[model samples]
Target: MTDIKTPKTWRSPAVDIYETEAGLTLIAELPGVERDALDLAFDRGTLTLEGRSDDIGYQRRFRIPEHLDAEEIAAELKDGLLTVTLPRAAGARARKIEVTVH
Candidate 1:
């Protein structure tokens, strides 16, 4: 009988999100994922993250709110932890209005 190879199974990473004055922040636990092996993308109000290591892999997706600015999104990977910051669009952020006497 010939030997057959089974495909590798991937797992989802642990993630956490937080609400801030400017917008939202996402934190993902990527134990074995290297910075160069990680992929992040935001499009059409959706956020996608994927990563892989020699032995394991991870993937996850999130629906971003319309108010968030996808163009200015940023992320960082450090010590096996990934931090993503989604800043609110200029029009969506809270601002102070000045009242003038007529």
Candidate 2:
């Protein structure tokens, strides 16, 4: 497991996190945040989001789940909402096995 440390600029925001069969989804209300101003980064099993909305600064850190494939993560900003999708790691993906008995 990677040790995740929140940055000093991190701020708790009103957001919702949900997990689905495909991946993990994060929805954050970032009113007045422009697409170009928002930044998303993932490193060492830590996901960070930072941006400036109307001169107000905001930062947040999320502990990336062990099952999540940080390299495949994607984020989008639209209608003042930031949506992040994190795909599961290879070892974490569901697999099927068959057994034969004689």
Candidate 3:
């Protein structure tokens, strides 16, 4: 008997979304994925992540809030984990209010 391998279908990776005063952060677990095989996109208010590997393939999408800065989003991948950070827009960040005593 000979060993045979079948093609795998795309799957949804495990993800965690966090929101704070600084902004929103998305963390995804994608083992055995290469840096060049990963694809990320942010258009309008949606963010997409896709990766293909010999054994696994996954893709996921997220809707970003309007108050966040879409253009300056940052992404980093290490140890099979992907971290994406979306910083809040300048106007959307919380600011201290000053009171004038007359």
Top lDDT prediction, candidate number: 3
For 26-61, candidate 2 gives per-residue lDDT tens digits of 998887777777778888878888776554657788
- What's the residue-level lDDT of 52 in candidate 2? 66
| Error of model 1, residue 41, in angstroms | 1.3
- In model 1, which residue pairs have backbone atoms overlapping below 3 Å? none
Worst 10 residues of 1 by lDDT: 1-10
How many clashes show up per model?
A: 0, 0, 0
When 1 and 3 are scored with lDDT, the better candidate is 3
The 0-to-1 C-alpha lDDT of every candidate, in the order given, reads 0.86, 0.78, 0.87
Query: Which pairs of residues have clashing backbones in candidate 3?
Result: none
Q: For residues 18-43, write the lDDT of model 1, one tens digit per residue.
A: 99889999999998677778889887
lDDT of 3: 0.87
TM-score per model over all chains: 0.85, 0.80, 0.89
lDDT for residue 65 in candidate 1, whole number 0-100: 90
Q: Which of the two, 1 or 3, has more TM-score?
A: 3
